[model samples]
Target chain A: MIKVDNISMRFNLGIEKNFSMKQFVVDLFSPSKRKEKKKKKVNNEFWALKNVSFEVKRGEVMGFVGTNGAGKSTLLKIVAGVMKPTEGKVSVGGNICPMIELGAGFDSELTARENVFLNGAVMGYSRDFLQSKYDEIVDFAELADFMEVPVKNFSSGMIARLAFSIATIVEPEILIVDEILSVGDAAFQKKSEAKMRSMISGGTTVLYVSHSAASIKALCDRVVWIDHGHVKMIGDAKDVCNEYLRSLGLPVEGEGNGA
Target chain B: MIKRVWLNFKKYSFLLKQLVARDFKIKYKRSVLGVLWSVLYPVLMMIVMSIVFSNVFKFTTEGVSYLAYLLSGLVMFNYFSEATNLSMSSVVGNFSLLNKIYIPKYIFPLSKCLVTAINFALTLIPLYVVIIIESFSYPDMKLSLLHLVLPYDYICLFMFTLGVGLILSAVTVFVRDMLYIYGIIVLIWTYLTPIMYDITIISNPILQSLMKLNPLYLYINFARQIILHGWMPTPAYFAACGGSALIVLLIGMAVFKMNQDKFIYYV
Candidate 1:
């Protein structure tokens, strides 16, 4: 089970642009454009998420549907334990296997074989478990012959296949995925979807964020529609996804109206 | 705090091992000499310094061979320099990884420091080689069982380096200025530590006294006592070396803890 209560995330939009002390000092001594900025001690706070809350029950598959910049990824990161929310609390009561940005722990200089072990360790799998699953990962990725080659030499598609293969090797109690279903070529995508279904049916709790409305309707038991950092709607997947797609001026599956 | 750190370390111990090995493999992957480069690097530096200091600076150790004294001080200072320099950028260098998944943020800096620690241990081979060669020349060279205490001194030195490295790594997440300024500070710090010259030759009492306050100076001085003078440190000396390291470590851990939650936002 997972609980997210009253979560908010704030970003200081322009802070990193003026990160240099030399630039600040130079601007301080000058009297032109930056003078007004210096007088106010310069701040640009943008709230990325505001007062949002949700819950995922054990063995439930929940989908998040939103436009770009709707704070879906930020909420996923908070639940994944990578980022701290500015307000509110999140409690996840099981082991998490996050597939946020696949290949997060890979070093390009390392071989595929080495990255399998390193990337697995980063996701909290023990070396022994990874060793036992090594062949399975290679077989699924279909890189058995290329395991010894450095990851830098692998094509982009090959790398993504390897990353996806290493990430889903375990049946985690809580799996937090972020827009990662589209990996490798078309054939590989079908295989990975099958793999995902097996994991979901094996009683794993899932929090999935994706752009594909069909995958959400196919896999999610429930869907949360977020608009501008607010939970716009939450209920059964088919209804919420229909409403979500309709709101964007696209025709719903069983409707004749079009934007 | 200790228990929490131990638990975190235990949980990530395999990750830490891979991180260390990843760097080790990358560093020597393209080189023909492989890890022998670590041993050869200090010996080569010692050769160049031996010529310049002996003839150009004309500095001399009264009863100790300059080669022995020079290499001992160089080995310890080099470890400190490399560890802290690399550790300072550890957090920002792994921005992609840190933002994507949850990692014990300290692991970045800790892994870099551990890699340098391995190289530092290997560099001791060069230092001992110099010691063996100088034993043939310097009549005062007494190869006794007391020299085994060198590894104990290294443990204390490692703690001090890691303490300083932790603080630098955490501070660097917010202040990009530290990245540029640390290079200049290290250059000045090397000159102030008496690594290339004899400290006793300075006539000014206050300047000499201030030099003694440097932690690197204290570490080098402590190791020299075991290697050159064959003297076991007094309990006060032991307490001073170990105590300062412990205090810095406590402060480092505290600073890292307070600032770690804000790191993701900044990085």
Candidate 2:
């Protein structure tokens, strides 16, 4: 469903320029040894994603396991076509619903109902289609009574619930989830996992990035471990999860604590 | 092509409608007279300019009243200032969507123009009342000059606004100083464009030639010619304004498209 080839992203650290001489001189005499610090703030390229390549077949639940700053989110963003890689290419052949950020299209002044339609439109659902799925979305979100209320007034959990409901309402061909399940209460998290499982079973390919090996084992059919923006391994979920857990110094299977 | 913009317009038409309605509501949200603020601003400016310049710059308005002459130019000038200033920050200001979605980037600026157009339309009511009152008061008033309210000038002004807005938006992405510099520029730009004074009042020939080269000067003149002078601009004025707008729009689009890929990184 998606292919990435030698994708890399280099960001310039000293992105802002054209500081005035007065401000520069003021910084030179600041209270906390400013001159030394200012001298070190030169433009440098930091690679967020380095020459990473991978593929996900149709209906495959692919887990992207990586530590913090492992470029997992960057890879997902490239696949979602929101950010272009500085080098190489990422080609995706499906309608992609990227759960990159919750409440991305929500207007604080707008009501929950208005936001659902707006967010659905942003996620590529036409008005008629959103209208068709409206009931199910509201039901899944469990916000039927508060449908007319403004989203800004909703609690953080309510907002996440609504956002997740809108994203999963339509059965997209490719779903890219980044840390979305990390939100909500435990029961809601279980509901989210169930919904994803249902979608995966019915031929929706998913690329889920997470730091939790347990979540990956619970959801994915295949696991692709990434370390420092490079693919570490790609194989069956159990083997990769065992290897990853072993690397983290955790005992495998029955050797662990009470479950 | 116009078709792509046309399609985007159709696609975003509902959002446009909602935003325009919301903008009107938001602008007048707390005021007693609501949208009346739009007309009040230009009317106040017209009165001030007419009072300030009437004694010093004595060019007969042919038969038009001084206030009429001032109002016509004031309306068009407001359109340019409002459109360009709003557009310069329109993209970056809405970084939420610009960073996430893939839609026509020009929509942000274009939407600003559309909102300002609504404001422009509302401002015309006072001008109409002022013109009628002045025409009745002055026996020699050139009623024929009212023909300048033709829709074509509005189109020309809008196109000019769009072209300039796009360029300013693109430039602002690279140089953040533009945000502050443009406030001073608009103040100076209004005087340079002959909004309050007549171009013929300038005794120097070089300044007259230079005014002809200034596209905003030409646009304001085009609006004034139609509304106060009651005649369409010469083919040369049309060619100059249209040609310059097209060139700026093309260059702006090119720069916007080239740098669009880097917006996520920069933002």
Candidate 3:
């Protein structure tokens, strides 16, 4: 089980000085030539997530549907042990496999085969484990012919294929993916979805974040609608997605609301 | 706790092997002489010093070959200086692995120490060759007189280098300019450590007592007694250097642990 309680994050948005150049320029140059005006106050503190609480049971496929800047990535990182929560507790019962940034650890100077082993080791797999599954990893990435060539020479899609292949190869109790399915071509996307399907079928808990309502409906058993860093609704995928679409003034299933 | 260190040992063993291979390859990748370049540096330094001191000022080695004495000190001092200097930048330079992984941060510094040890081994071939040549030329030389009899000194030198490297690596994280500062310190340290001159050159009692507390001085003395005088160090001297290194290692580790958490935030 995974639980998050009362998590809030704040960021300071300004320079470390008495005045900013924009403010100074505005103060010096008035729009009108008539009279002096009062100074405007600037807000510095901005909250990204405010008192968010949630719990995910074992083997649950939880789709996090949120608008842009809704703190989805931050929350996923906190649960993945990559970042600490500022205001609350997040207790996860098992090892978390984070596919947050695919291809993030690959060194350009190293070959694809070498990078696969190194990346796997960095992801907490021993060399023996990598050795046992080496053939499968290379075969899954479909780069057998070009495995020895440097990764810097690989195209963006090829790199994505390799990263996606290595990420899905590991078996963990909880898998956290953030906006991964949006990459690669349609065929590779299908392959990634199939991989996730197997993990779901095998009873691995997953927290997938995406803005696409269709993908969430296709994969997640439950959906969470988030806006402005707070949960607006939590229920079945179809119901929550319908409510989220309606809030955006889009037509829901069986309901046509004219904009 | 031992198991955690053992796990780290297994993890870093592969990393260190890879790094050493890479270091040797990159160091000589474009050079024409390749591995021979390691020999050329000390050889060239020995020639220049011998010509300048022996010919110009009649500064003899007082029965010992000037080349052998200089080479002996050079081999050990080079190891110490290079290891400490390289470790200063090792942590920041490996920021890619440092930021992504949560392993012990000391691995970066420790790996550089291993690289230095490898290079030191390579350089010792020449050291041995020179010692044999000098012994043959002198005719009164005994095989068990120097390093062959007094192996503890060389071990002390290695320990001291590891300790100093740990401290320098930790300090270099906060002060960006410490790399350059450490370079200057190494130059001054070589002069003070009796690497080029003997410790007895200082005649004052107060200065002599101060030199006793200097860890490098003890290290060079250990080397000198083994290689030049053919005797083992006093137990007290051995204990002093070993204890000092252990203390520095502890302090260095403590400082590194305290500051390692903020590395991602800064770099």
What shift in Å separates residue A22 of candidate 2 from its native position after superposition?
Answer: 5.5
lDDT string, candidate 3, A1-259, tens digits: 9999888765544423223456567656776521332221145556677888889999999999888888887678667765555688889998777888887557677788878876776566667777888889888888899899888899999999998888888899999888787567888888877887898779999998988888888889998777887878889989999888888887776666454
Task: Please give the ranking of all candidate structures by lDDT, highest first, separated by commas.
Answer: 1, 2, 3
Model 1, range B149-258, lDDT digits (tens) per residue?
76767778888888899899999999878998999999999899988788988789999999898888888888888777778878887777888888888788789889
Question: Which rank order by TM-score, best down to worst?
Answer: 1, 2, 3
lDDT against the true structure, each candidate: 0.89, 0.78, 0.74
The sequence of per-residue lDDT tens digits that candidate 2 reaches over residues B1-267 is 789868766776655555555455456755897777898988988877776777655545556678987887788888889888998998788678756655456777777888999899888889878877886766544457446544666777787788788878877877778999999999888778776667787889998888778877776677666655556678877777778777766776777777767767656
Q: Mark the regions of model 3 whose C-alpha exceeds 4 Å error after superposition.
A: A5-53, A65-70, A84-90, A182-186, A223-259, B1-27, B30-32, B45-63, B138-170, B203-212
- Residue B258 in model 3: shift from native, Å? 1.3
Measured against the true structure, the TM-scores of the candidates, in listed sequence, are: 0.96, 0.87, 0.80
List ranges where model 1 is wrong by over 4 Å: A22-43, A257-259, B1-5
Using lDDT, give the best candidate's number.
1
Error of 2 at A158 (Å): 2.4
Using Cα atoms, each model's DockQ against the true complex is 0.79, 0.37, 0.17
Please give the range of 10 consecutive residues that has the lowest summed lDDT in model 3 chain A: A33-42
Chain A TM-score, structure 1: 0.92
